[model samples]
Target chain A: MILRLGADFLVAVLFSLWAGRPGWPGFVIGLAIGFVIVSTSDLAFGRPNHGRRLLWMIHFAGYFLAILIRANLQIAREILTPGFNQTPRIVRYPVQDLDDLQVTVLANCITLTPGTLVVDASEDGRWLYVHCMYAEDRAKAVNGLQKLDDRLRREVFSW
Target chain B: MDTVRDVITVILLGSGLSFMLIGAWGVVRLPDAYHRLHASSKCSTLGLFGMLAGAVVYIGTVDALIKAALTLLFTVVATPVGSHILAKAAHSRGLRQWDHTLSDELADDQRDGPPQV
Candidate 1:
């Protein structure tokens, strides 16, 4: 709670600076407003995991950005090249261990990556139906997605 | 300093534009909805990220940076959700895959009983 308040204070100062009103008065005013807004919203939303969410956001930004760049390049190359070296496939990825939110996050992460799309999830939420643009080696593609899942499990959703 | 900023902006904006064009081409040229979604989602997201970076650098204002950050955040969150729903709808609507598609593991799973998770 104290840490969350500290972060709110810092963000308030940043906002003050961004608004071209950087000063003690501005900082104090921003701090009060930021605190009230952030606290009220956080309470209203019933989010007890603010710290983890922030960590996930930071990690996700860096990790997703790196992969996004690579995906762009890879897809561009495939698009520009002549012969059809790509094989499209839809694979059902198992995800029963994860809760609903985790499963949803995992599905979205797969969709966000290049060359893959989440077609559907099983009724029980145990299987993620994913379509891949390049599936030359089926095991390799599944393994790649599994790797992403492990990362999300270990890094972002770690308790 | 201004010249350096201009150089950075050009580099970022050029790549962003290239990705956007690639995405558009993929949408038109790709065989099916799923394939096109791959190109559209990935390329457009990265392209937007690049363009936002360029804008933040060129403008060089704290206000601009904050706005850019918010836009980037929204893009990151929204794109995947949008694509997921579209892909789900396409599949449910019985959209045909490209003729060359080698496997339908999901269908096979549905037939054979889903793998135990």
Candidate 2:
């Protein structure tokens, strides 16, 4: 506990210097609370590979936004057009990054997109159960997500 | 000496407040959850860091400064993870997304590799 505080304080100092703001009281208070909260959670849950996990997570997050924004724009267009045919169907899209966390992320991205909903997700790392909305080209809709995986692999994971 | 510190402190406080406000705005204005996370996480951390810097300067101690700095770093490190988890959980829960998702990562996973993380 002593060590934890010490370590937290040390980290707080470093971060403050880097951020370059002034005022001691709020900084100290907030830092202490943050440290305690994070440590408690870390202790309760086994320490994950913070370095690699964080790396992957950050990249995942970055791409996730790009994909999400694009998806929203596409949907708006579909909605405004009277001829828009919202033919939603369940399809199997193959998934990788065998980590359960990664798979879950992918599944959710699919469901979130407009005109589509993930009907079922049970492929045993072989394929993902995906539903598409107005897929003019089945291959195209499935192909779009590949860039996210590539970005994640290149930026976050080596393989 | 005191005057210098006071000026620095005020500046820090002002900047910190701005960041917090910006983050709040982002939370509301951003198009979707993912965008909101980007603005809030990135901006909130920046704001927190700014506030901490002010604290360090006011205290005028290397120890205090170091502690403040650590807070910034840890927050930077931790926030993305939290955001990632939230995003993933949101996605799985079937939140609606933009339609123009180009270069589907999952499709690539199907052909040559795995899915998006």
Best by TM-score: 1
Model 1, residue A133: C-alpha shift (Å): 2.2
The CA lDDT at A128 in model 1 is 88
Cα lDDT tens digits, model 2, A20-137, are 7545655675576657665666667776433355456677777654554455445444433455345443455666445776665555454444344444444466566554555567
- In CAPRI terms, model 1 is classed as medium
- Alpha carbon lDDT at B87, candidate 2: 56
For model 1, how does the per-residue alpha-carbon lDDT over A36-56 read when each residue is reduced to its tens digit? 777677889886655566667
Write model 2 residue lDDT over B56-85, tens digit each, in one string. 888887568667867876775566556656
lDDT of each: 0.82, 0.58
Query: Can you give the lDDT of residue B114 in candidate 1?
Result: 82
In candidate 1, position A130 carries an lDDT of: 87
Interface RMSD of predicted model 1: 2.6
Residue pairs with clashing backbones, model 1? none
Best by DockQ: 1
